[model samples]
Target: MKKVSRGQRKQTKRFSLHSNSFKQVVKELSKTLVSGLVVAVASNFLLQFFQNQFNFEVAWLFMTEWHIELFILGIGVLMMLYIWFTSLIGNRYIGAFLIILISIILGISTQQKMLLREEPMYPSDFSMITNLPFLVKMMSNTIFLIVLILLIAISVSIFWLIKRARKGKKEKKSQHQKEVRGLRIGLFVLSSLSLIYIYAFNSPGNLVKAAYNDHAYWIPYSQEMNYYNNGFVGGFLYNLNVTPMEKPEKYSTEKMNQLLLKYEEKAKKINETRSKSLKDTNVIYVMSESFSDPTKLIDVKVSKDPMPILRQRMEKNKSGEILSEGYGGGTANIEFEALTGLSMEPFASNLSTPYTQIPSLMNHFPSAVSYFKDAGYSATAIHPYNTSMYKRKQVYQELGFDTFLDEKTMTYADTLEESPYISDHSAYQEVLLKLEETDETDFVHLVTMQNHMPYTDFYPETTFTAEGTADDLEAANYFQGLSYSDKALNQFLEELTTQEEKSIVVFWGDHLPSFYGEEVVTVNGKVAMHQTPLLIFSSEKEKQESLGTISPIYFMNHVLELANSPVSPYYAFLMTLEANLPAFEKGMYIETGEQESKLEREELSSETQQLLEEYDLLQYDITIGNRHAETANFFSSK
Candidate 1:
């Protein structure tokens, strides 16, 4: 052994060097893989924690429940992103920096969305990318600062690691270079495989959905619970499996025509009973943002009644709660349903704002305003807020509104003492101007923004407070806002009575305020969680029978019936559906007097079941299917 030549000694040293280089490369790759796993878990927890209203108990459930398949899928996604970034930048630490940066943004958005929307962020939500600046404002300063600190810390640490790695000596033509290149190439290949396995282009055997089906528990109706049961990455991937609109299996032009023919006859019979017409009456829909009474909420105590005028009106007209599609936000969806008489429960569960989605696709979108516009009424939309809030400018144009008066264009732009938003009284002034400008029959769609979020110390007269809430000051402010809105409505209605023109004011709250904690859900029932006040006030008409709790899709039908105004065959069809089922919203179906929110299809009568099927068919025909129903004059008022 001691008789080795100098050449053999050199060869032995070279072999040892190569082996050491190989071990270093293997170690680096192993470390990278482990890092990806850790980030995946941490990111997933962050997302779930925020989505679940920052409840650590729910976040820890994932760790205890062994959501192994979802965790594996999440790891795959992060590794794929990491590998791509590392390969493109030629720096593993830089790749990590970018990955963490994206994770922070995504986590914050998910949290904010959960707070404002009472649901998880859908893939469709990102389509409203133009509203990013406004959407970002929804995040509280506390949350923003915490996220900023974490992000800056992560970025600096990674930058320092990158600089340190660059300072180390690396040979150009050494075994170390080859080893490094080989490891990166290997990781790149693995990431590619991971992406393909997780998603396979609409394949039923897709791993992302398959994992959810096998391991994760999810509800088709409740999106928030879906995010809770499945982790963030897992829930998002599961939602991705949804279609924008599934064409009904039995959908055909001939079938749509037959249903239209049947509904036309029913409309004729219904119209014969109506006394008055839409000749001189003005149809006005006032959507008060977050206008619900705080006293109705569990554990919320108000010093005095905030909505006396609304309560009085509710008792004297077709009034009750409206089952909202969203809990905390989604004003556009409620407005769309009220205007179009279309139920979102039947539409794909994942569809975002139909104001943008529906109008973008259809050339002939017949809405309540469209019908009124067709019948010699001037359609006017007034909102004392930014026109671009929900893409309302485009949507109002699509709805064939004649005059669109927003915050910038409105006559009255007065703000409350402490609030930055325009007052409801100012919003009502714009409507009065429209009425005075033209004596012709009018349809005004007014959305008020006075009661919008960030309700902190709004009014000096504020006397409302909550004992059990984490934030009593906020609750007090929100209740005070409702009182102000009530006063505005009272004054507006009195002014309407003084005017010569006969008008019908339909007022509703979009949804509950987002400040309510999860404890509210535990105290208040789920069905009650979605309830908001609804009233139809006619200048001349006296008290009518209560409409009871109903979905917004039935809103126009009830309005028409109350006004004794003739309705289109489409409205007649919706009225029939509403009769069978008074409220079907967001996934919960509530019978008029029933407290049981979840009603199974099996519990329905055969006739009601069949009518529901036909309802779905007709909606599909009008919205997603060819213009079979619309062309057949299914919406033409007799």
Candidate 2:
């Protein structure tokens, strides 16, 4: 071989260096170009889907609006960049390839989510659509479209990769192209600048503050397209599940002293005349589902006894028409009302239970577990359904229960048929078992579900005694369910009486059963929902007159009185309402008596709106979390 010259050797070295550098540049360019395009396509598809699904104002509405979508896109972009960085670090093209694969999977998942009935991709609810027969057919079409798009994306990604590799090989001998390189860098910078601009100036409030401080600041974006998506943030997420302190400024202890004195005098009179030593009692609260007194029920003739058991309980036990605050159906609201003696009427609207929308109220309750627990009772709760159904597990535990038994650990004599719910008799069996197990020092809280319906359908034939009108039949079906529940109670009572020591069994229906169809409207009056059967049955049947006649809120005070437990100071009771609603009578009585005090103290007293908002915030805190409750703090200073 001929010996090479020094200049030739130097030229060879330069060529080798240039070749390697060019290859590296080409590889990075190819990876970014391919990955960026894939992400943009996926993002654009999401944008287009949202636009068709919702009327968004921005061009890339998915990225600009809908916080969830934005989060997804942000995560996608970050992943893509991460892939690009990793590729550079490892000196291999694997990062870009992995990103492309993940993008396709995510894109498919997003599209699939839109088609599912459970929480559609868009904020706009398609839940009503699920009721439609055509929904399944429509979803099939969506599936086909998503599948096609995914295939196309995959094919395009593969084609682009192959094209880049081919081009890189062909340009192996060429000098690095400076103009093309500059253009790529310029495009990257422009894209980044656009993202920042859109994020900053596109919405309301201080963007920086929302980004850093607002717990649900993303909500504005989440609902940028669908306005109804803007629900109470204090609900189910931010508010601490505590009862709110009533607006302290509204009523003063000095003003409330007048009422406290009256109560003191009344207690003195009752104590001086009435016997202070009360018998150990079993207070059975029968809570009928969706129960309301229908004027038509009084008029109509039916074949069966709808409320035979309840009627029997009412006649035999101390019963009254307890005015409940709800319509159609909201069980937890009534439960909250009954347990805390907090009237839900002041806060009632589309916003039903604080558990779902407000968690703050969980802690702000004017009455609490301590009240019952302090009264020489170990409170045990039983529900024959999923423990977490409606978040009951947490709510009940937080409210103060020594033992909470749901469907998970519940015993059943008969298997549940048709639905996941247990039979009424089986539920009662569990109640009886609990009653047997509890020490004499414990109290039982039972939430029954057998009466939940398809109204006429769920009523057991044996419980139904063919007797009144169609209204009677409805009542009868309710009674039949109640009768079955009553049988369970009778068994529980019989067992309880045999015990050497006594315990209180407080069993009440969560709400009246909700009837569907137009026929229901024709029968029940508009306000029929408020009329529910509230029966308090004690183990030892004393003259019924001894049972207190009062609202649910007052039940707490009375429970304290019955068990002879210590009552909170009147000031603490007043302050507690700051977080929860006191009964209508109590709130009104206080407001009425403090009229002069209210006029004297404007800033010190809570306005009607402020009280309602505070209550709402408290409810939100219990169900949601603390962040949501703080939103209502806007009114705190005012």
Candidate 3:
């Protein structure tokens, strides 16, 4: 080879330096891109899995405009930020570990909320969660691991390719410039495509940058026209196929009032049939959490009967599955039903709490309180938790209670239960003490919280067996809490029976215990709504009147009639497709009477939905202030 000229040698050295710098920059870029891609892929896959697994679509359908948008944006933003930060802080192994841990915690929390966030008796799909169990769990873990490894490898290889490309830079300068421009264009195109997607599919009414989301049948249409339509905007898309397929149900006010009147008559007839004079019977309503029908011998059984004390009283009391208007949670909604006796519409997102939203009804509480006051019963309400948690203090006082006692005043300083908390047993004791302390014969409402969630490690005084069969330590703890409450109740009743004053204890559960955290169990190819027991226990000497299988809405009315309180009128909707010519179950309504009208759960038969919907109205206002008064009395008399 000829000796290289000085100029050529200098040019080659310069080229080499430039090539090395380019390689370094490209390597760094490749690593950053790879990390981001891995995070995005993993997050999207996990999100899709969870959404499909839990029927989040139905939830989105039910959510209010604000909630829908808030939830989507909140979840998406939080998740993206978490992944983005994690990628910046750690290597693949650490990131993977964090992802798994966070996913599990998130899964549990979401599962709890999902389980409780629907109409009661929504059928579950046990097959999906239970089919292969250990295998599925193991496979999922493996898949994630494999994907993580593949991503790391891809990222490293891309970095190496950049190094090789840089070595050939001098000869390929013109070609390299062309490739760089093409890559930049491709990235821009991809970003534009993503923007189009977000705009098209995002829930309407939410500002894009302010960020929020929902889904109707129109999702496909919205997605297709995202470049222009931007979703439903004040009837601009009314002609679009994306509009809700289910038409807005319309009922004439006259027709609704007439229907309500009919139900009122039916309620009167129920009281007549029971023959338990509701005239002046003191009512005790006990709303237990996760108080399932399993406590009874007639239904399922736990290894050890958690609610033994209550079980003993079940035979004598007029009780059965109250067929709750809610499933895993929505305690307030159920409380609304027990109080108002109104039919709950499925499509109505504004049905959470009538007392909070419907001011007209809320404003009437003073009248209810005064009405009982005139009838010689002072109204008081008691809750075994922070009174302010649910705004119960203001609401209770507004509803006419002479006094409102919450966890703070009701719990004694020396109680075994501990600060910021009181057990159901302790709550019952407080109730009794209040009744004894009060000079007036009064109506009391009690809300208990000892049986509330994270049920496993919550009780300081009680230790659950962490061993076999009781895998449901959480549920077991909940029931144990309930049992303790029952024991307190039994003792209280014994004392009340000795008193000369006659009273009727109208106690029922506020809502079923939240089984949202429990793993879904499939028995005999069917999904079951864990049953809850509602009882109208009495200490008065009137003939023991027992009405069979009545809805919770009827429980108050039945008691009111027995005590001779004049009841407000109501109507039943009973339009479910399962029943022929719209049938009423007991004294309740069915917005959809058809068999398939189940609480949007597809696992159960359609007829089940009809039966479930019949009692759905108890989630609404039907019986005015009777429940509030009754609940107050139950707490005071405890």
Sorted by TM-score (best first), the order is: 1, 3, 2
* lDDT of candidate 2 over 155-198, digit per residue (tens): 67757865776783653544455633554565556545544543
Model 1, 1-638: lDDT tens digits are: 57999999999999999889979987877877777677666766666667766788877776556576666666667777787677666677787778777777777787888766677777656656787766656668898889879988997898888788768767567558777887788777777776666655235667556655778776766777777776787767765534546777777777877888898999999989987778788989998998886778778666788888788877877788888877788888888888887777777755666765555743465588878877799999998877776678888887788889988999899999899889999999889888998868999999999998888767766667666665778878888888889999999999999988888888999898888787886699777878899988888776667877888877778778767888888888888888878887755777545668755655666776787788778777777678777777777785
The clash count for each model shown is: 0, 88, 67
**CA-only RMSD, every prediction:** 4.1, 11.7, 12.8
Model 2 misplaced stretches (Cα beyond 4 Å): 1-288, 291-301, 346-351, 358-368, 413-420, 455-483, 503-507, 516-523, 545-551, 557-638
Q: Give each model a TM-score.
A: 0.87, 0.51, 0.54
lDDT of 3 by residue, 1-638 (tens): 89999999999988986786577547644764665456544543343333334455543442334234333443443334434444444343344445544443333333333434432111112112333332133233444465457557655765665576567556535524544444445544554554444444324553443342233222221222221122212111222212111221332344334444555555455435443333344555567655564434222345565566666676676555554555555565566545543333331331234444343455343233444565677677777666544456666766667888875676542233432246666766766776777676766777666555545545555543322222356555555566666676778778778776666676666455544333333331111343356556667644344443334445545555445544433221221222232212212332333432223333345665544443332222223422322332211111
CA lDDT of every candidate: 0.78, 0.46, 0.46
Pick the lDDT winner.
1
Candidate 2 lDDT score relative to the true structure? 0.46
User: What's the true lDDT of residue 471 in model 2?
Assistant: 38
